[model samples]
Target: MRLPSTAHTSRPWRIHGIAPDFRVEDVWALPTPGGPDDLPHLVGQFTEGEEPGMAGSSFAYRTLFAVRRRLGRLLHLDDADGGVGGRVASLRDRLPADLLAAPRGPDSDALPFRSVYLLHDEWAAELANRTVHAVLHLGWVPDGAGGYRGQMAVLVKPNGLLGAAYLLGIKPFRYVVVYPGLLRSIGRRWQETAGRRK
Candidate 1:
């Protein structure tokens, strides 16, 4: 479900250290519930598929994503010069000493992002293109029933005026289509892991 930005900003996330300039675009309470240690399971579910959070979701989500890709390709929005390490530097280059010592989880085969750091209850990954440089941060928080649930925060730095307009244009669809579809897939994948834990 959609959450107030404070849900993420109120927490002392490591992301604050690295990308303070980036705006918090979205914060969500993922439906995956489990013990504290289950965060790895949560992360695994998200990073599992060739197209994470697409399977079992409404076809609208896939179509939106496909359209995005087609547009990006035609406009050269995701070209080599527009991506991380090209248009802008990777967040990894800005990691603090302690975060550098922390585990940098494996890069996703499914997404155009690389791990930043992994803490006991938090994991962050970064992606960038001509439009924006962004971070996906997941945190495991107490769900108030003596269990934990995942929370996701999206942080972004728009490249320029074009990036700003780009973000504005997609906000409506992201809320109405993208996030809903993603949350559904997360719940489905998380449930599949439940039986194995039995």
Candidate 2:
């Protein structure tokens, strides 16, 4: 479910230290509820399939993704020179000594995002292109019940006016189509995995 910005901002996330300049674009409460020790398992949920994210089994999302990719290609939005370590620095460069030494999360071949760090309760990945530099922050948090559930927040630092405009243009689509469909897929996947374990 979509959450208020305070849901993410109120937490004392390590992300605040490094990407203070970035703005929180969206926050969501994920459906994967579990015990305290199950936080790390959330990573496996996303990485299990050939496609690494919420595009699975959703024709609308798949179509939108394809359209965006085609647009990106034609516009040179994702060219190597416009990506991480090119247009903007990787968040990894800003990591503190201890986190730098800890286990970074797995990298995905299908996704442009690269894992920044994997903490006991939080995980972060980043992607940058000509349009913007963005972070995908996932955390395990109390669900107001005894169990814990995954939460997601997207943070972004726009490149310029064009980037800002692009984000603005997509706000309706993100809320109406992208996030709702994605969250539903995530919920279904979480349930399927839980069922398999029984």
Best by TM-score: 1
Q: What is the lDDT of candidate 2?
A: 0.86
Model 2 spans > 4 angstroms off: 52-56, 195-198
Candidate 1, residues 1-198, lDDT tens digits: the string is 899999999998888988999999999999988887877777777676766768876888899999999999999999988888898888989999998998887677888888888888999999899899999999999998998899999999998899999999999999999998889888887887797554
TM-score for each of the candidates: 0.96, 0.94
Q: What is the C-alpha RMSD of each candidate to the true structure, in Å?
A: 1.1, 1.7
The number of the candidate with the highest lDDT is 1
Angstrom error of the Cα, residue 108, model 1: value is: 1.3
- Cα lDDT, model 1, residue 14: 83
**To one decimal, what is the Cα RMSD in angstroms of model 1 from the true structure?**
1.1
- Lowest lDDT block of 10, candidate 2: 46-55
Which residue pairs does candidate 1 place in steric collision?
Answer: none
**What lDDT is obtained when candidate 1 is compared to the true structure?**
0.88
